[model samples]
Target chain A: MLVHAGNSRGAMRGERLCPAEVKRGLLDGNPWQADPSLANLSGVADALAGNGPAHRIIIDATASGEVADYHAHWLEQGIHVVTACKLGSGTTLERWRAINDAVARGNARYGDSATVGAGLPLLRNIRDLQAGGDTIHSIAGVLSGSLAWLFNHYDGQQPFSQLVLQAKDAGYTEPDPREDLSGDDVRRKILILARAAGVPLASDEVAVDSLLELAADGASADAGLEALDAPMAERFEAASAAGAQLGFIARLQDGRARVGLERLDATHPLAGGAGTDNRVAIWSDRYCDQPLVIQGPGAGAGVTAAGLLDDALRIARSTPD
Target chain B: MLVHAGNSRGAMRGERLCPAEVKRGLLDGNPWQADPSLANLSGVADALAGNGPAHRIIIDATASGEVADYHAHWLEQGIHVVTACKLGSGTTLERWRAINDAVARGNARYGDSATVGAGLPLLRNIRDLQAGGDTIHSIAGVLSGSLAWLFNHYDGQQPFSQLVLQAKDAGYTEPDPREDLSGDDVRRKILILARAAGVPLASDEVAVDSLLELAADGASADAGLEALDAPMAERFEAASAAGAQLGFIARLQDGRARVGLERLDATHPLAGGAGTDNRVAIWSDRYCDQPLVIQGPGAGAGVTAAGLLDDALRIARSTPD
Candidate 1:
């Protein structure tokens, strides 16, 4: 049973709450009343403190850095933290080190599987390979689902801006398509993967080639979008003439990370993925000749939630009474 | 830190043994002396006992059912078992149940990642998906490294028998190539995956269309292999005419499992793999339209050892002090 629930909005004691009902109420925009005594993170933490020996877990489904900030504290208190937020391990190296140190100091588990590639087992595979004494030489992937969709559907016939608009309309991109086009999301993902592969890559160390720069400032949004057409079309046609496909790739090799648009051969590992699929290739000592490739739907609420639940189940099962 | 070691041939206490020395000795075909007191399984088990609070693990690298029989006993005694052998979960349903029950009863881990895709995260993904409440609809793959190589390399140009000989020469097939041609290994893999997906499919329930049946018996081994050429060539031609590729496929759907040669379209998820890659496509409620695909080199001694080491590390890390 759930003992406590909290979000950026508020916190509540979940002793009287039914999970199914709570889910329905939230989905229907008729949420249960928040407790006056449990309206903040500190209140929720206090309520979660005295829950006997049963394993305590905090499922952070939000993208808030505020929530991620408490991950170390919660873990240091012997509470397991299962998070979908990237700020935990994808941000500053200091925070990542703190979390690891806290986990060791308090003997807690940190489940961040949902932070990268949704639930595709990318991070787990990297960590496991490292644990097994395999040296990871490089890692590359189409890390962003929105960019993948845009690139996969972008043809020279249709303006790239039109495809971006369609992707936005389809709810595939962020509200501001610029956020998706800026290439920062892919950068974060690469940092997360690189760090997992034992590379200490800072956010600034990654060189990003932003798609947003292809557009020009104009009085209207559509006009600004039109400036992107010629540049994108030229790149696409050049790639096509060379018998290659264009992909927004995030790569970490020799401890340096980069995210950019690149033309890849038809036989390239990243070029084979279908619509919106995030394809990751890992080059390690064990898989040096032919890299291990994992491809799947990389962005979905259901999958992310499932990843969180999977982590929770693992913690619950691995913990002894 | 090595405590006890045993194999079908003998056993030894590792008090005076260095792991690097042992590895070099075995590779040089000059092994350390075996202790007579630790020459058998029971003797090794007795020595493994009374190791205080440190996590105990038994790494099974052999393909012997006799060794598998002791898995439950070891697990029940709170000794974790990390294995590359298939007998633990790929054999009888009773043995599978016994192992799982023993894990629960003894609070021990059973690391069988090496049993499936040589540590490609196939089993981990399936089990995690189930744990997270996702309903798996189906799973299909080209499972056998030997068969994958044969089919991937077999064009109508070369006789199938010649390719089999080449595969054998390349160390890609079993000593008796018929063991690979029999489809039983694929059957075991399918059974293991199906069981992981919550389908309790018995071994006999799987309908295996063995490729061995296509060859006729002859006085000479080469003559018997020659009989396989025509049928395979015809199938190859037929598939090529349809713009499809032939793959040795193992599939589980609707709680039924089957292993056979399949013709797949270019767009099929499992059709894109190259060389001896084991490509598995998983269909689940979360991945309904596009199956999650994992592809990689499925067989190698280094990878198998890395997988065993990975499982051992996980058991060690997850266990509380």
Candidate 2:
């Protein structure tokens, strides 16, 4: 079933959307009931209270960090959550702790496998390795799909601005391209990885070096591009001349995290990727010398949805019949 | 508590080996009890039958294929099985089906993640991706740590025989080094990977190319090396002249599986590992163009034990308290 609390255009407010109605809104495939009155969290909870326990709950929306507290509340109520929401787990360490604590107390699961790398097996691998008594030393990667797309296409042949515009058109960038350019998304992803690797890192601890130097408040895609082109062009030129490629690299090492544009040699592990692929290299005691690498499509509606569904299946299969 | 069914040397034919005894057998880290009466499957089963349901049972022994039926029996008795034994899952398709059927019938989990790649997360990733609706295309890798060591060190500078001897001395190769050279281990692993990718592949379906031309049966490390040097030398010369390196490559693609020595370019994903590191590249619909890469130490007592313990922990944590 599709239950929407709100929409970008503010159209879903106070409406309990059924699976069929949601499908119709998304180009009609299956018919589902529409509950116009089941709009917000409390309404959804009330609706759920009328039914047996859910197999699992899937959250796949933008900036889902706003519902971080609600996620904790749900976990405390013994409900499993499978989310693609970075905000909830990628927020401050304090909130991350609360959510984890609630999960433990309620014996419920919080599946954020889709939060980073579009449901890549990175987090689960880290957790498993740790449980096996391996200590993680560091993690580094090209985490942002939009940024990866931008860098992979931003050769000296094309103006960086053109590549940014193309990425936005390809649905690889955020609505405001500056969000991709600013490097905040990459920071959030790194934070998520660090936490999964057993690091209690806060969002503010990451030293982010955003591409856009101008004020980012209320900027549109074109406006963000205009502000970012000059600086990015310079970086591309310098990197190209030095026989290197530009990669928006995020690193979590020695209890410190940072994200920025870095020039990586052609032979560098993270230097290879076309389009919107997210590549990550994890370094732990067992994998310390040569990091275990995971690379794949980091973003896209289909892949993200698949990741969320994967988490749901894991929970369902684990739960007793 | 350690339960001993049998020992290769007939030393523990009917003994219950405690943790301290096992440690002492490994050069005395701690002392353990040695009960010689628990010598066979029926005895172990009888002991287990007297107890309540176990959360999990771990099988960490050589030639564990002999116990494939026993593992299925345990799983049918409501016991989860975590195995370092590839034989249970890598056996003939008929036996494989029976074990899987038992797992489903008993609603018991089978932790075969430790069987291949030393619990490198390869199998689980493939399973999860398939469940997530992604179609896997192919999986290729250098899966054997002993062979990987031999190849990485077998530059034309050193005779291949000497490298094999060194590997055996370093505890990298099987006691019967012919077992490592016969390509049987790699074939079994490829079969496991293909099955994990949802292919109902039979063991005989794979067209395996063994490294040794002469008979390897009952051959010691020295004897196998003597028989292997000529063919291996020819390969090294041809590959070296072509600026390529030799690796024992296992590939599952296009509904066919093969394992043998292959000449890989310098930049091949599996060619970068050093020492006993095993590297794998997985291709799928979502990651079709750029295969997901995973590299790490594929063999070692510490890492393998860690993998087994990791599987045990997974089954334990998933079981209700």
Top candidate when judged by lDDT against the true structure: 1
In order, the interface RMSDs are 1.7, 2.6
Model 2 C-alpha lDDT per residue in residues B1-321, reported as the tens digit of each score: 445434432223222456555545433322133333444554445544544345546454556666666787778776677777889878788878878898778667788877887877788788777877789999999999999989888877766778888898899999877789888999889998998898879998887788775434546546766767767788889998998889999999999999988999765656666778788888988677667777777887766777777777777777764
Best by DockQ: 1
Global fold similarity of model 2 (TM-score): 0.82
Show where candidate 1 strays beyond 4 Å.
A1-14, A19-56, A69-80, A94-101, A107-109, A216-220, A316-321, B1-14, B19-56, B73-79, B107-109, B216-220, B317-321
Instruction: Extract clashing residue pairs from model 1.
Output: none
**Candidate with the greatest TM-score versus the true structure:** 1
For residues B200-276, write the lDDT of model 1, one tens digit per residue.
Answer: 88889999998877774542466778888988899999999999999999999888999999999876888866677
